[model samples]
Target: MPEVPRTADPFTAADLVLLNGTVRTMDRAGTTRTALAARGGRVLAVDDDAAVRGLIGPRTRVLDLQGRCAVPGFIETHNHPTFFGLTLAADVDAGSPPNATIADIVARVEQAAADAEPGTWVRGYRYDDTLLADDRHPTRADLDPVSRDRPVCLQHVSGHFCVLNTAGLRLLGIDRNTPDPVGGAIHRDAAGEPDGVLAETAAFAAHAAMPKPETADLAEAIGLAGDAYLAAGVTTVHDTGLGLVGGPAELDAYRLARRKGRLRNRVRAYLVQDLFPGLSGGELSPVEAGVAGLGDDLFRVAGVKLWADGSLQGLTGCVSEGYACAPDKNGLLIFPQDDLSRRVATLHEAGWQVAIHGNGDGAIQAILEAYAKLGLDPLEGDRRHRIEHCQMVSERQLDQMAAAGILASFFIKHVYYWGDRHRDRFLGPERARRIDPLASAVKHGVTFGLHSDTPVVPVPPLEGIWCAVRRTTRDGHELGPEQAVDVDTALRGYTSQAAHLGFEEREKGSLEPGKLADIAVLSADPGAVAPDAVRALQVDATVIGGEVVWGGAGLDAAPAAGPAAGGGDGR
Candidate 1:
């Protein structure tokens, strides 16, 4: 079981034995075993009951599986950890009120204001511009009557935009002369006055005006995000765009999490290019290697992240064809092509992995062109460059990714959450049928992973798998039957594919002898379940580093058998 030779210390000592369980190892050939033992955080043995039991000692914590199934911990490919932390730290939750309209939002803000002091602002998030009853952003005019005493800002679902009331605008000192910053937009009405809706950088501007979260509060937010993911069966999360917003304070927050032992799941943080002026706009420096991959397995900075375009649902994602809802707009570029190319090239030249957010076909093409401009050769051994949200890829874009040895982490949930809107209002039937193009990328031999752009959607890997496997939307309509993958492929996208992205394939992902003992105990084998039932499976327990971190018997308390619809623990 301990075959790999290494000078590096093994995770810990084997103190746990998971026996009599269906372990979907996600091994190289998709092997399934019934028993496994963990010592130090690495797997000591993986085999049948007798074989694995032999490795267990008196100190071992034995977990009787009761015939349940286990798989690798889910890895989220694209997410904003610090930003999510800030959201958790904020008092507002605009996204949670699904039925709330403009009036409802104003009332909620008014109440939040009353609850707080006169000076404290009221903040909320998760607004879907498309679903707004007004089909447009609400401005200060709509909120002034409800609450003029305090500032109010509602973040859009994309996290890239926000709408502010008059108080918020005035507090932020954003008047007609404030002027939009480069790479950001300040929406204006016909008369050239601020419309209260700030796009991209503009929204970030409003956010900057607010008081920063206290260091202790930021650490707590990070802890909350970690605990939430761990409860949902995620052992690792790619902080797709950390350090992109929040400035140096956010970096300090993640650092604080590691320092305070608040971090549970592993984090492979990809720093936002804009976070570091030197990395973002200045010359490259090899000195970064000293700090790169710092920290233990709890968290590490692995690469640099950049936003090339916006999202599809909001009609800001750079698209090949104009949006079905906004045919006149082709989506906005977050960064100019020359600047992005230069920055990517500089980062690449300095030996940092570059992860770009490219959701649309046009954006993908632009990213590819930018990467090409850098002229960096794909290095030998696990150098996996990635496109964060390769939602709408053209065949040509797929070829570029394949040729560059780039991995396209597809947003599989797009099919589930936005498929209907995409079909009817965005891509239209013909093009919408090919939206995600997962199967196409697989057929092309391009490496890929699926993701839930958390806060954008919830951060669950299984949800993405359900979307990919079923290719079904909220209405239960299968968007593209041809794009659907079998359960196994979808599982690998979260497990193996994700591990490969993190350069941890050799130590994690699979239930192999020499791999890390990160696993999830589920109520049923996803592989054996019917496609439709995949989303209904429940997680009974979650084990990371061979330790049971969450629900075992208390799992029965999970809302799986309720009048409320129960979905599987996202992968």
Candidate 2:
């Protein structure tokens, strides 16, 4: 086992002590103890109840876990906090369970338009054309009925495509004469006119053109998102697309959120490459401008985010073979191979950890090729370059990633939400069955982490862990039992492995002396529960830096109140 740190004064009193519980110190040896102590926002010790009791002083806050289970708090590796927050605060929810058809979505938009002032853009999100009764993306004709005078845009659940009304097309100055961007498409009708569906860069351009939410509203949204994460026992989040909304000003919104006491979780932010001039045509990239590791622990600019391809479910991910449903149609790459390689090499050499989104096997291969062009041994350093959503990686790719030391952050929830479609329509049985392939990655000696990819999905780490372990689809069909991992491995994907992906292994990810006292108290030990019942285990309390941030009402320690509970530079 790695050496655990101890305080200089063994008699120093602890700020908090949790006793009579299954303390799973997710350490190198997987130590288990009945009690744990914390002081100065760091773990003091983990031992039997009697051994920890000595650290409890007169002012120590004690909580009796009553035999419940306590493990390290979850660390979400890839998510879009700014975009997710804005969606919750401003956008219309056009997801299924509420709107089953295209007409239903049209009606929802009509209602939203009626409620809003005239001429303002009406946006809807999380609409899945594949799941809709119409089985097609909404066109300008369908959305025009809502309001031809208003510009309306409906985002696909995949976030790779969107349907814009005629008014929106005109607002963005896109038409039949407009040529498709190098890495994106403006889907056209039989008449050679843009059909209002934009893919990849096209959709991204439209989103960038749309008006940004007010800074105050953005801060509140951040707070709301943080509250949700805290309730789910997530102590840290990797905002994979920083400056995604409102460009560089989005960083200011984050600072505002932190100042208002709304930003609670530790955020390791990745600058969206497209939004930065340095990554584009400018001379000084953000890294050169000293933006890397800019903030304190609460919010730090960690790396740069790039996209290799699009979403698989949306038929935009670059697959090695044609889609099972559309044999003639292979997805597109977001960047040319040479362009991607050059960009990656430039960023890697500039000291930026690059996390490229690659959902399909072809895209994964492209990313690997890009890494290879760097001509540096990945294993030689702690670069920790990552491939996000490596959903369709094969054994060969896993071996390459293992040899190259690239981390795979799998969006494991896809098995539960889209596994059936992937098997039946997207990739066919063989490929779909290997989607996420946690067991194969493990066998090939590749390190991996699990993510929800919120607001693509909710930030429930347990659901991701369950999906990884069970490999079951929404309808309870086992999509790939062979790829299923054990509970401990699944847990580590969300905890230890996730922390490592963000380069934060020493400060977080486990319960150990000298580590931050970030923990989640669960109703039951997930490892002890039946595999099928693990998802049912609730988070009873969440502690961040030795402070109870959510739940814990029954304990003597009151949960932190409002924005004051957030950590870091009193910005």
Candidate 3:
């Protein structure tokens, strides 16, 4: 890869100059430099302090970094922006004590219901199944005391599912006779009544009944979510699933965020396939031209997103072998092969980059086959199709990804958070090593991006980096240390590597000339920190496109609200 010039004149007139920091550019060759000069949100020049000072003029703002470590702004490849934003607006703290159980959750919901006016909904999130002492989901009986006049829905930790109280189920008219939707499950008891555990699209539908936020509310939520990302040193986020309900909703949110200049970081929003309704299956124009890849070097619609399989916790992740915990079951397919193939083929043929969710080995193989079936040449620039959460890929699928030029966004943090649970209950210990094979992806010449599936986990790219670098489980056991990447490699996966997946490498990711001036100042040098100390590292500041979004001084370090809570989680 040839190096692009930083700017037309990086060492000349600029809007700002950040000096005296360790600048980790994450460039093509993986090198670090000092002192960056910026003009109108683009990196103009990078060199030593005295040299960069020459570019600073009377109007230029100079920020002395005081030798803090800097890296390219973080880019998260998979997240639920709209859902996260909405959850944030509800303003309920879900990351309570690890001992917080179903009864505690019910109490919290009752309190929220009391505070809400009649007919207004009360929603809560971050309910962990393992922590529930009853080992059962809460039902309307559990929450009826909260408010029968108002509906309440609490999303399970895995966004793939949720448990809606009777009021919610009744509001939606989901009764004993309501057959399961095409791609979802409604958990029922021996009495053949709704058990309130709605999985897949069904769970999503219950929450959908609640009023969608207004454009202004959405705009605020985006800012809140974006600020959260920036605070964690993230400069860009690939919103994996956008336009879930429809284009108008998500588009309005992202557009409003950009128009208000509230989006400090770039968002590559992958429009959800479910949104492109009633198309005749031909070449489609960009979803909405002006805003598809819009904004002040801050946000863009990177591609189209599709989910091929279910989630690990839900026991729906499509695996080649039966789950260790459920020997007779091989997991569910969210989209059967033929339908998924048609969807991928249609999207790719229409010139839109495609990203498919494939968590199980079987799902990964299906994705690889679809990419091969396309028969497109690899030399094509920007085709960069991605496999989000390539968690359980096989050796053959690894070869197929390399051969087909498929980029992978591995949810590596799963190895840390769920490794023990997965090994003991889901994928047997022997098959666990094959999960999120980072080293294999590297050996096969596949470009792998790392991410925290926010709302599934927190949206910290450093935690993603830490997971890839350590390859250890939560119990302090080294699952496969041989698969661990060095700090430089893991850092690239979060920065430039992630940018390439979103096709924004030219505009962001690296601090090279002409790239957006999105960079993060760290509390310690990642390279110098001991491998185990990676997760302990902190952010000093987060600058996106030449503007400071989060200044770390005296910052409130509390965890953000909602089920996708953040913490060590061994990542």
Taking every candidate in turn, the Cα RMSD to the unseen true structure, in Å, is: 6.5, 4.8, 7.3
Q: Rate the local accuracy (lDDT) of all candidates.
A: 0.76, 0.85, 0.75
Tens digits of per-residue lDDT for model 1 on 245-306? 56567778877887897877888888766566575565754556455677667778888888
Using all chains and alpha carbons, the TM-scores for the candidates as numbered come to 0.91, 0.94, 0.90
List candidate 3 stretches off by more than 4 Å: 1-11, 91-99, 245-247, 279-296, 380-382, 552-571
> Which pairs of residues have clashing backbones in candidate 3?
6-513, 6-514, 10-44, 126-563, 266-298
Residue runs of model 2 more than 4 Å from their true location after superposition: 1-11, 278-283, 286-289, 557-571
Q: Pick out the ten consecutive residues of candidate 3 with the lowest summed lDDT.
A: 562-571
Ranking by lDDT: 2, 1, 3
Of candidates 3 and 2, the better by TM-score? 2
With a 3 Å backbone cut-off (N, CA, C), the pairs that clash in candidate 2 are 261-563
lDDT for model 1 comes to 0.76
| Candidate 3 overall lDDT versus native | 0.75
Model 3 residue 50 lDDT?
67
